[model samples]
Target: MKRLIPLFALCIGLPAAAQTPQLILESLVAKAGPASAARGEQLYRAKSKAGKTADSCAACHTDNPKAVGQHVKTFKAIDPLAPVAQKDRFTDPAKVEKWFKRNCQEVLDRPCTPQEKADFTAYMISVK
Candidate 1:
């Protein structure tokens, strides 16, 4: 149990073991074309009003991606998504996809496309 707990801690903070966020974003851009921060911001702030937990990404993430957020239902503190605010926010591709999967379903009631992911990430980097 002791060994498992320590392993879990390292797994939780495995950002250094993952690809840099820029590389993943570039891959996304290659598939999705040039990303637009404006479009990303629009998507980010748009309310779906379909999910039970929240209306849009902004409902929990805040209008400003650089600001810390709270989970709509759990009230758990979420670290800022902006790269500038939190250096390791999107460094892990697996973690990024995991959250995108969960959050998109919760807010958009569907899976996000490569374009949306690219734009959203670009917007995160653009924040200052």
Candidate 2:
């Protein structure tokens, strides 16, 4: 019974660890909407620079929920847009921020603004 008390405490702690990020990410997602997502898509597709074009979210990732990236290279494709599909991939906040910083510059010629990040996440969630 004494050993079981510690085991139960450990088990209870596990859920709190798992849920904190989910809660924060969910709060961020809740603040997003379809209109903003549409705008985000527009921002993504718009011309980024005068000399060369930048990529959009749809460029590296297939827009369809079921489709994965077909290209194989420095920018190999995957199911990038689907939230349920990529949820496990982006669970780490640091990785999420890193990709946002890199991809936003690649697509927008700058890091994503907070609105863009919110809207883009909303759009990704909408795809699934």
Question: For this target, which candidate reaches the highest TM-score against the unseen true structure?
Answer: 1
User: Cα lDDT of all candidates, in order?
Assistant: 0.81, 0.54
After superposition, candidate 1 runs with Cα above 4 Å error: 1-17
Enumerate clash totals for all models, in the order shown.
0, 0
User: How good is model 2 by TM-score?
Assistant: 0.59
Q: List the residue pairs that clash in candidate 2.
A: none
Stretches > 4 Å off in candidate 2:
1-35, 44-47, 50-54, 70-75
Worst 10 residues of 2 by lDDT: 15-24
- Model 1 — which ten-residue stretch has the worst lDDT? 1-10
Residues 35-82, candidate 1: write the lDDT tens digits: 888888888999897777899999998888889999888999989888
Q: Candidate 1 at residue 98, lDDT?
A: 95
Error of 1 at 47 (Å): 0.7
